[model samples]
Target chain A: MKKLHYSELWCSSPRYWGGLAALTFIILLGMAAAYYMEHSGHWVTGMSNQVVWGLPHVFAIFLIVAASGALNVASIGSVFGGPLYKPLGRFSGLLAIGLLAGGLVVLLLDLGRPERLIVAITHYNFKSIFAWNIILYTGFFTIVGIYLWAMIDRKAQKFYQVTGFAAFFWRLALTTGTGSIFGFLVAREAYDAAIMAPMFIIMSFSYGLAFFIITLMSAYWWASRELGSHRLEKLKNLLGVFVGAVLYFSLVYHLTNLYITQHHGIERFILLDGGVYTVMFWLGQITIGGIIPLFMLYSPAFSDNRFAIAIASVMVLIGGFVQIYVIVIGGQAFPMNLFPGKEVVSSSFFDGVVAAYTPSLAEGVLGLAGIAIAMTLVAVGARMLKVLPESLEDPEQGTA
Target chain B: MSGNREQPKEIKRREFIGMTVLAAGAASVAPGILLTVAHATAEAEGASSEVRWGLLIDSNKCAESCNACVDACNRENGIDLLQRPQGQGDEMWDAQRPQWIRKVKLKDNQTGEVTNLPMMCQHCEFPPCVDVCPTAASFKRADGIVLVDRHTCIGCRYCMMACPYKARSFIHQNVEQQTLRSPRGKGCVESCNLCVHRIDAGATTTACQDACDKDGHQAILFGDLRDPESALSKALREKSSRQIRADLELNTGVRYTSL
Candidate 1:
């Protein structure tokens, strides 16, 4: 490609200010919810000893995972030298940073003592994966920040490959760390699988690409700029492959569990009798998140249609939330079988019963706030910086 | 100018010999001030390595419907009186309450035999809670008591998720006027510490064990597992006691008899 010209997205438009206002309002509301939950204690929320992590975690985790995946476009461009993806690289890096910042905000706010986050930073517990993740998350920001800078600065352009590669590997570690947060949980039958790590990586890839494609299409549309069908095709095809990979992992994970006699009860709970979770698995995660997206991306009828692709991206996002919900809350709902053969008839705590959790309105606001915060960052940053490309219209001038 | 006055001192041989003697004298007394060594079967002013504090519960002696231990534990830990929103339903408050110990009535399908046990933190030698704690707040004492250090606990509750026994409870509400020994608070995960405060204060057993004995059940026995002559150890040797979920190989400090 010839030298691509970048410009700041105009900030004066009513559409821009309106979007910013809406996002800020939601963010403030979320902050208030967090304060209430913190001050009044977690009892106000539906979260109990059983379902320790609630709705906010679902959104925070999804965003964090999606953040790592968002950088894949830049990785393909800079790390693998994908000519078609090079123009999208700057926007991809910015999105990754924005998404991470948003996710971290929700997570920190949800902490038992949000003020004592300094302890999490200063204390070293190498044995815990959570401690390792803190390093990975902070390191990701520094590495990706440098990677973004390298892409933008003419003097630092030569070092793009090094920084880009570092960011790529860092993101992989970040997602893997995120997955292992559940996977390392040996006590929970639902989370003790090794596949969670790779599954999350693939999940990140699909969710990230879906997010990127949607944002790319809409941002260009809002600017009244042309985004070629060729660029869309590249992203669409890659998204299908990722979605398929996730399905394969999900299949193997269940199959592996089915093979083990010890795991039969958990499998039965998740696949068959686990009412809400079962429906979520089949309808939300598999059918909506997985199958529909695959059909949209690969089907000849919908392949060329931008609207279909957009719908599929949104479906994948919806599915991503349900999938995380199943993994986190569903896993907790299944009671721990402290006594293998003997059935626990009664207990002071709700033992041997599927724990109940209904996400409170406060939690809902907090979760949506995370998404709004991410969008706001993207909106403000795009307006102030030379992030978005001028156009992807001229094929003759394009690297592809 | 500041360095010139301090840097010029050179010690003579006699003065150096005198200084060395004084240093040796300080070193000799330092161990007494800073160090406390282990003594067998005796309280040597700190938790001892020679004693592995453990609990032995006789399921046969425990009544199937009894909750004395649970109630005692609740009273001792200030868990029973934890503040909640007024007018909250009993079921809602029960679910929200922090339970350090609970009466579990288990029925064996194969033999049609029923077992009654009070379940709490097993205080494992290699506790998964301790392993997964991000801040090392969920820690095991030198004497094998697993307790949450409230000061350091971040309330992430990853330890609660990691616990196989479901022994840990997260305080989901703001607390006030907690028991003198256990300072209760919201967001932090807590579990039975075998009444470490009582043990440290020279009490021979935990609150639950004392409650059970007072109730005339004599099901719960607390003693040193490391000492072969200890009642807990003797009971283990004489009776077939098993750890719940022994397949995990946690080597728990809490053992059950006649299960």
Candidate 2:
């Protein structure tokens, strides 16, 4: 095998400057949006007592889940001994940290009392899965940071495998903690299933890989790097498998819910009657996010086409967002079964009726800003550090 | 003879002055002694684990049109004073405002028999809100009243999501005006605290129960569940009461009869 060489992203290019400027603009806008929401209170937003978590949560959760998945590439290289993936570890580590930072920023800013974050850190209720998640998330950064150091530092190279193993397990725990945030909620019918944890893990795999692919492609394309078709093919194929796994989990989740008589109402709401949620499930998640991407990745006609592969990855991301939206927002929309055998005829509270939510401009801006922040971090890291491999070109015959 | 008269007058005057001073001292000390005794009595009545506070409601006695309990709770908790922020839509404001208690009318699916009752935080022995709170801000008092510590509440809303009865409400807007008893603010999760201030003050009843009695329905009865001779315990023994969502086995402090 050829010896690997790494280089920093060229910062002198006009395109680089332009991209940085755009990301900075978006980040500024997001900050403003956050400030507006914080100052005016949540009443200014579409979120109400019924739909307490809105668009910001969807974005925050997506980024957090995806952050763990982004590290999968590094884990595969260092832990599993995938030779081709080894060289990509540095960038993968950078991307993972970037995604997590972006996600955490959004989550913190969206809190009702964001100023009192110190209380959250100091006070912990051991029984709460949320409290556990705070530890998991912070631990992820520490572990991944060490893993990245192991990859980059020549002196620390010997510890790569050990750090990789730790980071791998830590990422799994992080994703599990994220999933349990929903799974442990016994009050909601849509959540509270053991399957939620595994499903979220699968979702992270798909979303993280999709994000990694798009970022890799965009960065290489911009920097005039020789990214070989073989590497692209391998990554896209893996993405397809993750997508298929997600679809399988989705099927099992719904099927299991359907079998239980108690869950029939929630199942029916998501599958058949829930207007926006049902449409998002079938049209956005299953078709656009799942089936089409699988087709693009597996089919002979589209698999080789880089543009098609990119589109497929984008679709997977869109589907992932829709899936989370359905889970978070749609789950809350279904009114709780206060009276199992009784129909709520009237109440001052919006009982027995679906809660309504419309994403406000500020919410949308804030969500997009998280993505911009993640991209900015990756961009800046690449520019400053020798994270990216010099080239991913296929070796000539007999070169090894 | 003049000196002797003067000396007698001085002694009489001195005696009168001393008697008046003693009277004033006793009068001042008496109220202080009485107040200390009252304070001690109040302290003795402080929330105790032995006395489990709970509410027992008779659905049959709840009048459908009378919203006295909910209205009274709003007044008592200062929930009625929350004003809609300027530019907030009426519908949105209605959904965002904090509601400690609300009247709910349920129709039995099989029998078509309608039942009217008030719904609020049940103050479960094992409250899911308390269990899910990351900061332990949502906690059950020693006497079984579940409350959110506003200072520590990060306003994650996880507690609201965990609650089964839709009992909790998030304060979405800045609360400029709040009752001294409630002390609510924006960005914190709140629910029915079962009129804990009244309970702490040694009041035997809640605002909801008081209003229900004034309305002559007398649907709500507040008392110590531990007290066997209390009116709530006696009524519970006479009537078969069931907790909402008893299947969850939460062992709720609030129980409803004729539902």
Candidate 3:
């Protein structure tokens, strides 16, 4: 091993400016969509009284969960003493912060009254998990910020392990808080299970690592830097394990629901009868998001192909988003069981029937904006700070 | 000296007559004064914890065709005045519109018996809406009436998700006109407050209860559950009544019989 050198991203290229401008345009479009929704009301969106949370939540929750997982590389370096991961720690922290900011912005702008954000900040019910999450999200920023500082500043290196440990636990708690948001909903049949917390944690691991790998490869490629095959192989392998864990949790979640007679109807709906939900669960989530990525990463035929790895990572993100959609939207789409044995023949409130939701164009733009915001942040951070290593070439190749 | 003594005697006689007249006047007005003061005190105190306002609904008596309670609730809350925004579809508008109360028809799976009832907020003692509200905007009054403070509600709709009864409605469009009693607006979650304005105005009856009585059904009974001597309490004592989803043990302020 040789001494590592880090530098700011080279910004003189036309590609850098083009990417920034594109991200800016998307962000502006998102803002306009948000303004339209706010000006008209929630009626503009496909969300109704039945499906209170919609597509925006799907994107928002994905980013937030992935944000915690983005810090894994840094944790592996400082907390677990992995020297190979050390050079990646600074960029990990930067990505984590960027992702969180993007998620929070989408969440804020989608509010029925975004201006009353101060009310949400100042007033809190301690009993509510939502209030607890607000605190957890804020604390994550502070702790991760300190961890990034420790890794960057030479004088602060002594506190690296302490900050790393704090960041690690805080991210775990943050993901738990996000999962518990649904788990604690006693009224909704799809979300009452206690398994939601651990499931979300595993989900974060897969989604975050997948995102990290894609971004890392893109950055290195753009910089014309040599990223060794060994590092890529290591990341893809870790991603496979995380994806497998997510699948295991999904199996347990569905199996547990299947065993309980009470959850039979909802299980049947998601697995068989639910039109869009079933397709998304099997095709988008399980097959595309889970199985395909695993095959691409582990298959010997595609071992040397960088394109296959990138595609697998992209697929993982797509699958993760669909998984969230099934959870957030599909869960709400199922009618609540107000009467156990009695069937609802008539009701003004759309009871005993599946609620319909179709994501509007405004919602789509707003969700895309969150991704653009995150990418923009990472790009800006890389350009301004020495967060990226000069090269990840093998020490045996004399380019370390 | 004699003239002075005579003046004093006259004064004493005069004082005695005045005292008797004053005593008579005080006796005549004292009851009225006491009643006025008591009425004022009740109004000043607002909703009291000692009095748990509740509703006793007789589902057996509720007519399948009659929507008196729903109509009354809408009219009273100014929900009827809300107009759908331009270019909005009827199906979407129906889903988005606010409904404080609505009729629900249920048939027994095994017995094949039909039942008609009006569904609204159960006003639970341990309201899940209040529990899940991050801003504490969804709160229960001391008198057991659950309410949403529009001023503080960020319209996050967590309360809507938390509500088991499907009783809450989010205001989706701009409310151009609303009754002063309800003061509703866009971007807020609201539900049946059980006509809190009427309760505070010293009215013992709710709009639904009044409408039910007028329609010759008398299916709804509004009273103070704490007052055992009240009609609602006596009815509960004589006939068996159960709260909806009693297994949750929320001890809902609303109860139904002959379901």
Clashes of each: 1, 0, 0
Interface-residue RMSD per candidate? 1.1, 0.8, 0.8
Q: Measured with DockQ on alpha carbons, how good is candidate 1? A: 0.53
DockQ of 2: 0.66
Candidate 3 residue-wise lDDT at B225:
91
DockQ of each: 0.53, 0.66, 0.60
A305 Cα displacement, candidate 1 (Å): 1.1
Per-prediction TM-score, chain A only?
A: 0.98, 0.98, 0.98
lDDT of 2 by residue, A1-400 (tens): 6678888888457899899999999999999999999898899899988998999999999999999999999999988988778888999999999999999999988999999999999999999999999999899989888888888889998888899999999999999999999998887899979999989999999999999999999999889898988888989999999999999999999999999999999999999999999999999999999999999999999857999999999999999999999999999999988898999999888899899999899998999999999999999999888899889997665552
Candidate 2 local lDDT, B1-259, one digit each (tens) = 9999899899999999999999999999999999989877887766789989999999999999999998999999999988889988877877888888888999999999999999999999999999889999999989999999999999889998899898889988888899989989789999999898888877999999999999899999999999999999999999999999898789999999999
User: What TM value does model 3 have?
Assistant: 0.93
Lowest summed-lDDT stretch of 10 residues in model 1 chain B? B35-44
TM-score, chain B, model 3, is: 0.83
- Inter-residue clash pairs, candidate 3: none
Model 1 lDDT tens row, A1-400? 4577888777447877887899999999999999999998888888877788999999999999999999999999998998889888989999999899889999988888888798889886899999899999999999998998898887999889999999999999999999999999887899999999999999999889888988888788778877888888989899999989988989999999999988898899989999999999999999999998999889999978999999999999999889999999999998888888878777777778898888899999999999999888888888877788888774664346
Best by the TM-score measure: 2
lDDT of 3 by residue, A1-400 (tens): 7678999889457888988999999999999999999999999999999899999999999999999999998898888887677889999999999999999999999888899999999999999999999999999999999999999899998988899999999999999999999999887889999999999999999999998999999899778888988888888889999999999999999999999998999999999999999999999999999999999999999998999999999999999999999999999999999888999999988889999999999999999999999999999999888899999876664443
- Full-model lDDT, candidate 1: 0.88
lDDT of each: 0.88, 0.92, 0.92
List the candidate 1 regions with Cα displacement exceeding 4 Å: A397-399, B1-44
